[model samples]
Target: MQPTLTGRRIIQPPRSLLVRVRESVDFLARHSPARFAILVFTALILVWTLLLSLPISSHARSGTPLADALFTAVSVICVTGLSTVDMATHWSGFGNALIFIGVNIGGVGVLTLASILGLVVSRRLSLRARLMAASDSNASRIQAGPVNEGQAVRLGEVGNLLATVAFSALAIELIAAVVLLPRMLAHGYDLGHAVWYSFYYAAMAFTNTGFTPNAAGLTPFVHDYLFLGALMFAVIAGAIGFPVIFALVRLWRQPRRWSVHVKLTLFTFAVLLVAGTIMYIWLEFDNPRTFGDQNAFDTVFQSFFMSVMTRSGGFSTIDISDLHSSSLLVTDMLMFIGGGSASTAGGIKVTTLAVLFLAAFAEARGRTSMEAFGRRIPRDILRLAVSVVLWGATTVAVSSILLLHITKQSLDIVLFDVISAFATCGLSTGLTQDLPDSGVYVLAATMFMGRVGTVTLAAALAASTSRQLFRRPEERPIVG
Candidate 1:
């Protein structure tokens, strides 16, 4: 007890366990959102791993092995759909439900989910909290002191961003479910089963998960253009990124009002989608192993579907393994590029590629600044893009070599799986299922690292950057 200046006896508050725990949590919430996101996802994967390892989670007489269970958990948590086992036949209802839950959590993001929870619990997030969440969700880092830089998002705007992400996902998934349900029912699925399947595919499509509840996967829907159309719509909507969606929603009538980020994303996305579709059609049109057996309409439809899915949608209307060597090469490039920044899709992101090209274009034109849409792109952004590309390529290359050594698979197949894992795109050439336990672990680790690595590297670099207090003497190096 301590005497107070108020002439009364005062008792000091004791440091109890609850207070310590609260303090720790508060520190985590305030200090680093990126680190917190990683921790939360890691913890969730652990919980999922334990549940999936249980006998009830699998339909087989024996429970899932720890390695398989862990791999599945990581894949779902990372929203990467690659699986070492058949999700349909190997797991029971309980297991599927857990997977569904994991996919949803992984899709929306840990920081966004936590921010929503905080909103529910506290009614509103504090400025620091919003900044933390925004730090994790922002497609690119907003510089500290730039009023007209056009990259900074206000704290107030973050609330709207969070709402937009949740509402957009829910609305799109609901629409997809309604559209897909009736079609599935007409395809011979019973009413109740169709409902479940529709919603499952909706979630998978919008999240770019590529997971299928049906035992046959997307094989039965190969020729069903209407169903494939619905899935592609959901996939594109989700992969376009939240920033673009917000821009479009806000400036529905004024396209010119959209930010450069939105413009670049849309431009790049459209180019890739059209080019990929055409390339797939040109390469695989007459191949007996792929679309050659189908009618012209079916071939064109399947080619378009394949193009969309390759951009991190993870679905396919044709056998990926049957594609010609040239087609495989195209698929590799598309998967590597992935989707738009801050979207449900993975890979290095579309904006990075756009920025790299824009920079090169400016240099070729003898311009000092990277200008686009009448605005100059910042040097920091260019550095970030280069870092992301180099890091992503390094990851795929290293992982591919290791897998090739372990599985003794062809370089093409091994490289495909490795790139797929690194991009969080689940397209496979039949190698995922046949991989040994060690190879499975490698892919699982690759998925987790890919999911977290992209954002963490960007955020960490942005957070650690500081304005130099002094300048070094300038030197000119030799030109390339």
Candidate 2:
């Protein structure tokens, strides 16, 4: 320490570089977790990209191209299964291991993962850290306005919620892996190959990422209903989000005690699942390329499987291109809605759709407030839902236009692939593999924005939130 001229006090030496960086990071984590999350995700993608680009990462002893490497990294980090190169053949053992690790990190979620890391470093979660973690469960916490405690995971339970997130993910993946190992072994794989592939599929299914380790993809086990059923179970568990899992674990026997969020998510998911299955069977039952050749039982089972995959599971037993245009449109809607919030799945989320529909129903009934299961929904949540939907639609629309122009592809195929990217759904019409570098970059951005979330991206980009002290003069606009 340096002494002052007057010798009354000693001046402290400047903080070291490492100390300064830590302080800056702490500030960001506390003040702007949304921005911090985006930063963390971007940094991880870059690191993975660098690792994937190395010669050892590929089958051949040559560095992968920048575009392919970056796209793969983004897809892995975003937990999106879309790939420009053949995922099973293009990468070597080292590259595949990197991918396996990346999906697990990404699957834990950006905000939740950041909170976990914060807890490890600090040995405790700060107030701001808890709030940030809660934001992952309930996005309404991200707003500058007053928070409705009723809508969020309680502050006191944030630690438990974090623990639930980690434990449930591991437990679910492990069970699925065990269920799959015997199936793989029965299919003529040796012990080593069976163990690795079984766990690989479990991670992919639980992460809702559709990357298949083998070049044959899921074709070898196409008729194995038991194997496919296990994958579906893992995918649904992952798509439901951690908060829902936490709630279900506590209130398993008492459906009435379930939170409004859990009820809506499960109700909406079930409805969509049934609706999608019906549509697929109705449209493609007679089509030879997809379901026509299958027996009645096989056709129904495949339709149900495809419906589940559209929930962001990404695995496909048949060629996506062979489906009717009408079926593609149906798939588009399902993909656009995506899965639950704070999940490995992407898009605007199932809760957003539920809120919008409830609003519409309430309006038609001449009710002032939206109510579900005896609880009234707040206006702020409705406003957030609207904003999320608009942002998601705009993103999908703009990306579709750009992709169509770049690839000169038909609107049907281009829109399907674009929504697949925007929703982080890996089921493609075989278009992703043929895209040029320019198109690849655009799709990658869509995947990043989708996986990071529309609301989160908006919150991260906002400079500040301004509060209005008073309301403006009341004015009425023309009705729809």
Q: How well does each candidate superpose onto the true structure, as a TM-score?
A: 0.94, 0.97
What lDDT tens digits, residue by residue, belong to model 1 across residues 289-378? 888887888777788888899988998766789999899899999999999877888888888899999999988999888988888888
Candidate 2 versus the native: TM-score? Answer: 0.97
lDDT of each: 0.84, 0.91
C-alpha lDDT of residue 438 in model 1: 89
With a 3 Å backbone cut-off (N, CA, C), the pairs that clash in candidate 2 are: none
Q: Write one digit per residue (lDDT tens) for candidate 2, span 232-298.
A: 9999999988888988998899989888888899999999999999999999999999999999999
Q: Largest TM-score belongs to which candidate?
A: 2
